[model samples]
Target: MSRLYLGIDGGQSSTKALIAKESGRIIGHGRAGPCNHVRTCQGRAKFFEAVSGSVNAACNQAGIDASTVTFAAVCLGFSGGPEDKEAHSRELIRSTKYKITHDAEIALSGATAGQPGIITIAGTGSMVFGRNAAKKTARAGGWGYVFGDEGGAFDLTRRALRAALQFEEGWGRPTVLRAVLLESTGARDANDLLHRFYTP
Candidate 1:
């Protein structure tokens, strides 16, 4: 009998899955919708959908039915912290063993290939992780856009919007962002933009 392993990344933007042999040779790959915990904290249906969808696609890509194959181990890297609650999602797929953790851990391991190195990730979220020569690991940031998310696009956009508003009020430096935002959003003036931002 041959054994297979599954690695999945349920990220903010998309979900990805890869099935491989014990020797690390990949056999199948798949993609699905967003499973970002930060965005779906109110419920877990979307999260489960993302994982199940990707896993099924990956099994199909391997020319097999998901119900017919059992992975030796399944690792799911999710886009949120406190993965303990995800244990309930295990039965959503078939695996002899299953584990779930934050996506950044998977990112670091892939970046270093089991070696010592540091990784800085910035997308819808931001974080920095590092592993030392002695294999000691440490992490910083990743508190979400509302709290820290310094380098994330959301944070950058918020800054730009604030600056644009300030310039309109004649209390900040001039920037072309104000003109561009007006053109893109079809706002009649800076006040219209401000009203839109505050109301919606």
Candidate 2:
């Protein structure tokens, strides 16, 4: 039997798991819901349950049991960092023989792969992380849903909303986005505009 190593990259909206050989060639993979244990679960025990579900789901997808893995590592990049989420981190460790660290750090490691460079991520949130050749790492943005993440989908939606209002008031030039937006949002009239926020 070949030895397998599991690697997980957790995010705010999803979790990705990769099962690979010790030589680092990926073999199996799986994904699940957001891994923000603290925010998703109201308490510690509940958070552990969610983590267990994620780990088991991944293992099941790979046709293996969690205990059978020769080695494993989990990267947790969520809204909250590990320093403030020690309890949740501990719970995850208790469930698997894996090294757990912040998700951003994992991204950095993969992006550079022992080299030095900058990596910018734009997803539900935005973050710019970089490291110098000498191993000095730095990060900017990733302040969460509020305070920052200005160029992400959420921020883009805010601008769209403003544009919609502007077009409605006849203060701005008409845009093709208005029709696409209105159709997707199912806004029958002005009264239905309130539903746009919930649509996408």
Model 2 lDDT, full chain set: 0.65
TM-score, candidate number 2? 0.76
Which residue pairs in model 2 clash with each other? 76-103, 77-103
- What lDDT score goes with residue 63 in model 2? 76
What tens-digit string does per-residue lDDT give for candidate 1 at 121-170?
88777888888999898988887777787887768878889899898889
Residue 64's lDDT in candidate 2: 74
Tell me, by TM-score, which candidate is best.
1
Who wins the lDDT comparison?
Answer: 1
For candidate 1, what is the lDDT?
0.81
TM-scores of the candidates in the order shown = 0.84, 0.76
Clashing pairs in 1: none
Query: Each prediction's Cα lDDT score?
Result: 0.81, 0.65
